[model samples]
Target chain A: MTAQIIPSRTAAEAALAEIFASAKAGLPGSGAVEKLREESFAAFARGGLPHRRIESWHYTDLRALMREALPIAPAPTRERRAALRKAAAALPANSLVLVDGVFAAELSGKLPEGVKVTSLSAALAEDRPGILESLAAAWAEADDAIVSLNAALMRDGVVIDVAPGASLAAPLHIVYASVAEKPAARFSRSLVKVGAGACLRLNEMSLGAGGRAGQTNNALIVDVGEGAEVGHTLSLTDTRPGSLRLETFLVRVAARAKFDSFALVTGGGLMRRQIFKLFAGPDAKGTLRGVSLLRGREHADTTLFVRHAATGCEGRQAFRYILDEESTGVFQGKVVVEPGAQKTDGKMLAKAIMLSDAATMNSRPELEIFADDVICGHGATCGGLNADQLFYLETRGLPPPEAEALLLEAFANELIDDIGHADLVAAYRAEVAAWLAARARSETRSVA
Target chain B: MLEIKNLNVAIGGRRILNDLDLKVAAGEVAAIMGPNGSGKSTLAYVIAGKEDYEVLSGEVLLDGENVLELSPDERAAKGLFLAFQYPVEIPGVATMTFLKAALNAQRKQRGEEELSIPEFMKRVKKAGDMLDIKPEMLRRALNVGFSGGEKKRMDIMQMALLEPRFAILDETDSGLDIDAVRIVADGVNALRSRQRGFLVITHYPRLLEHIVPDTVHVMAGGRIVRSGGKELASELERTGYREYAEEAA
Candidate 1:
């Protein structure tokens, strides 16, 4: 008999095994859903965690970054709920609040007319019509290990459905607040559907309390109906140093539909936000824009994949990163035009500004076109601030730090000003200013 | 008052300015006319505290204060300004905002309160009108996509807003037409006061017709080879720098 060799399991794998062994019996769903959970976990087990060997995850090796998985978060208590409500109160009115990955109906304000919102767990328990179908649609196209793990362990989220031809009078806000007393993890998934000819504005924010280390895995799936208009924005900030966050967004745009997405990441120790957008019908338009401000030892990665599947579709992706101290930022964007997708127009750009010698940025922008008549291009640049520009601002009477902050703000304002909403632009600007202030304070302290 | 005594500057290990000596008293305007490679722009940049040039010897004094140890912004706070020959185009930063920030920063360094938004608007509007700068131009990015005349007008507007005690105009008339040059010269003439001084560096003496200088110096081989009164500008305009160039050689 030939000798057999076995590879040792990593810490993440060992933690996954333990979680699966203890939580399998109590997990939700049956039949197809149960089978899906089992199959997804099995797939994750077979592959372990993504490392440098995976081309898509070359810059962010999760297996090495995430040493061990924290235990699943416990149910939210009265005190935690109170704290969450306080935090939610500071956000815009008519917002949905999720505490510890569970939807809090009491905390959520009144909903708009012609809109329906329900808890994902309650829908799963009642076997709600179209719930399984909607979840299965995204599952069919997902091939990522982190997304697979989220599918296997998702506990609860919110389900939103907008009536056909209806236009929302006000924007909808979703606040995800993590209030864990100990080191823990929470997984949540949401589904949103905008009806044909309808208009919807959705905003999301993720906040974590300070202190202990915590992990959050959240996923969102959006379906834009024919001729529908959807505007979505996400803000992830105020994350603690020990926090680990992974957020994934999957969007499908139909014929003549328009979808715009903007995400701002300013905090978090380790984070990876991915967006997969599919242009399913002709004449569709989609845009993805983001800004990341990282300092300290924080590591943030944004990966985007936009596929043009129909003729005459257009897509654009732009992202900027400002890294300081020992932080690292990564941007990987790919635009693919399938065969027969004639007249497809796509462009992608990634730019980074490194403020310190120890700061690092990895940018990869790729374009793959299988069609002859398509126009697709991508470009990436990473460098420090321009010396001439800096000197110009300095001669205008600005100190070094102030000049740098102004340049950084101008760099990011290119995208923020394009948001077209006054309140949203103001909010984003305030966040950028706060980040710059903190950076200046830290620099002063170090110098002292 | 601004003074450069026995100044020697080297850039990239190559001597650019050799034993240059000049002085401009308060309320006086000095013109430096020279050929293409005479380092007129180098003198302007070195005075503004640009980092590229190395001062081998001598000192640059502003009101008896050695400015070599200060940064560019510090020099600005000490009332020194340079109107770039080719004004930089900074996208996404509105001209009005840049003006406000610059004004406030200078005020802050001098231990003064920041200007209110309305006050700032009033000041900019007054200066903008004098320089024929439209409101739309102020709303757009600073010098981005601006015409050559418009950029020089914007520079004059900045000079008016800051009201620096000492200003250096480096090739300020390089790209402007006759009408644009008149408007720019008028703007500069409006800001000229007994407490302020100016160093007007130009390739041609045509601009001197509007903002005539009190003294004219011919620069060649990196030094001021000849010094004369305002009549020298007209003389140099007609005769060129051939005589001074040969004398320096």
Candidate 2:
């Protein structure tokens, strides 16, 4: 008789098994959706949590980093929702709120004409046509264990749809806030569909209450229709020291469509934000940009996979990171041009500035081109702040910290200044200023 | 107003200046002319307190106060300035914002009230006009994409705005046309006062024709090999630095 060898389960795998067993029966969807969930969970179980063996996850070893997983978070109470509403009162009227992964109708206000917003769970419960299909369309293409885990465990999210040939006057802001007192996990997924000849502006934000080790696993899938224009901005701010966040974005741009995205990651304990952008049709254009500010033992990773599958398409990416204290920043970007993708142009650049002796940065920019007549290039640079520049500012009568702040602002402003929206630029500049002020205050505290 | 006594400086473990002694009195412009590799720039950097240069032994006194113990900004607050040979370009910091910040920082350090926006703007406009610097250039990033002449003019404009008590011009005339040099010299002359001192470092005597230094020093090897009036610049231009180089060797 041959002995059968069964691999032992890791803590993450065991935790997933327990969560899936408890939530599967109560989860939305049946038939195809149910089968997709089962298959995705089985796939996740087969591979377990992604570790160093996976090339994409090499820099971020989730198996070792995420040693323990917290239990699923419960829905926020009425009082909690009220407090969240009060706190988020500063947001624009055309905004939606997601508390602890569940879409809060009480917190959401009226939307403009020609725009429809609904909860994912509600759509699944009512068996809305094409809802399950849209959710399952990108499941197999994600090709990451963390994404598969999100697909298996995602309970609630929002579905935003813009009518054909329509345009929204104001940006649609979606705020995700975690208000759990104890350590917990929240899984959410959002799907956005911009119709043909339509235009939409989508803004997303993630925030966590201080003093708790919370886990947030979020995913977004965006489909840009033919000749549509979509602008998306994501901001992650004020996360707790023990928070772990993993976000994935799957974007597909159609013929003559335009997709513009910018993400600012300023606060987190452990974060890995991955973006998969595919130019699926001819003459499509995409610009993906990001800036990350890390400090105090934080580890942040931004990985991108830009694929040009059609001819006459162009893609550009620029990412910059500012790391301080003992923090670690990572950037892994790949531009791939498939066969027959002639006249494709792709460019990528990643730069980092280390502010302390213990700070570390890892950047890898790669290009894989199979087409004969295509242009693709990438560059990465990692270095400390220029000593001569600092000296120049110092000699002009500014103190050391103030001079450093000015230089760092200048470094980040190159990207921030290109943002087309004036309001968004101002908002991001304020956030940067706040972060620098906080850093200066912390330095003073440590010195004292 | 500015004095360097027995100054010894080494950079990267190599002696660049040895027992250098010089002084610039109030209202006087002292010019240092030297050949390549003569440690002229090192003296300017040491006076400004650049971090990499090791000051083994020195007493840099400004108005009877030892300035060697101060940081670069502290030295600036005490009214000292150094115009760089190669001005550093900061890509996103606007020149106007930098000027305002610098002027306000110095004023605050000296316990003076900050200038109002209109007042600061008027001052900058006057200084810009004097230096022939367009207002649009002031709105651009500091030194980024500036031509050689523009960069030199910008340095002179900064000096005009700051109005320091002691100024050191390190090769400010290196990358300039005749017109630019004249404009820069005119800007410096406009700021000249009895309480202010100037130390001009150059390789050629062409700049001395415009600034008209009271004292000229020929530096070779590490220390001053010759010191005389403005006539010394013309003499060096006629005979070249060969004799001074041989004498120092």
Candidate 3:
């Protein structure tokens, strides 16, 4: 008889399993969705947390890094919701706010015309037509344990629908805020649907207080309709030192449609942002760019899977990482050109700068071109700041800190400039500047 | 005024400068002419506090205060400037943005207020005109994709804007055509004042013809072998550096 031995689970894995078992019945979703959750949890439980052996999660061993999963946070109270509403009032008037992964309608703003917003939990409970199928289909090709866990536990998130041919002048903003004072966990999944010929700009912002130590798993699924133009930008700021965050961006671009997304991660304890994009129809264009500023033993990983599934499509993925202190950054990008995806033009580049002796960066850019008549390439570069450039700037009277900041800014600006929208560009720039300023202040304090 | 006393420098344990003593008085344009491998560029870099070389034993003084202890930017705040032979290309940093940052940083260090945008632009325009640095060039990334001549011209423009008390032009004419050298020389001459000092490092005598130096020093084997008037440059051009090399040996 052959012995069937199971590997031991990490503390986090055990905690996650117990939490799921205790909360499964109360989790928002109908019968089918509940069954899917059970199946997804089974899959996750069988695999355990992603470890170094898993090729996709090679650089980030969640099993080892995640010591224990905190209990899932309950919905915010009235006072917390009121505080969030007051805070939301300070934001732009077109924002939808979520607190601890749960939708807070009172804290949200008035969305633009022709736009319908619903809570994802509500959509799941009501068994809204096509919601279950769409949610189940996202990242279906990749058996990612984290995504499955999120699917099994996702409580609430904003679901946005833009009508066909509707053109919105201002960008719709979605703010995911974590306000827990103690250790906790939040799982949220947002879905965005843009109708054919529609134009939409969506900006997602993630904010957490510096004192809160928690775990957050968030996913954003976007479907760009035929001939639609969509731009999405995500900015994550003020991450605490003991926190952990994993975000997923799953996108599909349709025929002749254009989809562009940029993510700027300034501060995080341990962060992994994974992107899965598919060129679903011919002549669609997809561009993904990101910049990560990491320091203080923080680790940030960006993994991408871009599939050119149709002919005449174009895809570009570029990312930059600036690491300081003992921080580590990882970029693993894979581009797949399908057999029938002829004339597919795709390029991927990852660049990193190590600002200290201990900073580390791992870059792996892979291209799988099954199609013979396609153009695909990938490149990676990792280095320290140019000494000559620093000397040149110093001779021009800029101090070392300022010179370094300027160089880092210039390094990230290449991708930031490609964001296209002027106001959004300014906002992103301001955030970059703010991060630089904080670094400078801390450096000064350390020196003193 | 800038002074180097018994400046002995080395890199990777190999001596590059040996007891090199030189001075550039305020209002004087002193030229250092040297053969290849004579450490002229090393001297310029050492004075500017570039971290590559080891200062075995020396003192770099600006206004009688030792500057070897100061950082490169601190020395710049003290009105020291080095025009690189090969200006570094900093991608994505617009020329205008760099200029403003440099100028304002220096000003702030001197306890002076920053220039207004209009005033800063006016100064850039006036200085850039002398160097023929087009407005569009200033809009592009700093020195990125600039022709060799354009990079040198931009260096000269930065020199003009910063208005340092001591300026060292390290092979500023190396890759320039005659016209470019003339334009850059004109920019340097326009910035000359009694409060300013200049140290021009070059191998050939061509640039000296345009910006005539008040004093010329022939550097060989890391030390100044001969010091003379402007005629010395022409003499070196005619005699070549072989004799000086043999003399220093």
* Top TM-score hit: 1
Q: Candidate 2 at B92: error in angstroms?
A: 2.3
Q: Over 4 Å off in model 3, which ranges?
A: A207-211, B245-249
Per-residue lDDT for A278-314 in model 3, tens only? 9999999999999999989999999998988999999
The chain A TM-scores for the candidates, taken one by one, are 0.96, 0.96, 0.97
Ranking by lDDT: 3, 2, 1
- Lowest-sum lDDT 10-residue window in model 3 chain A: A205-214
Task: Sort every candidate by TM-score, greatest first.
Answer: 1, 2, 3
Task: Report clash pairs, candidate 3.
Answer: none
Q: Give the best candidate by lDDT.
A: 3
Q: Which stretch of 10 consecutive residues in model 1 chain A shows the poorest summed lDDT?
A: A205-214
lDDT (Cα, tens digit) per residue for candidate 2, span A164-194: 8899878888888788767889899989999
Report the lDDT of model 1 for residue A289. 96
Error of 2 at B110 (Å): 1.9
Of all true interface contacts, what fraction is found in model 3? Answer: 0.84
**Tens-place lDDT digits, model 2, residues B1-249:** 899999999999999998999989999999999999899999999999899999999899999898999999999999999999999999989898899989999999999999999999999999999999998999999999999989989988999889999999999999799998999999988988888999999999999999999999999998998899999999988999998788777
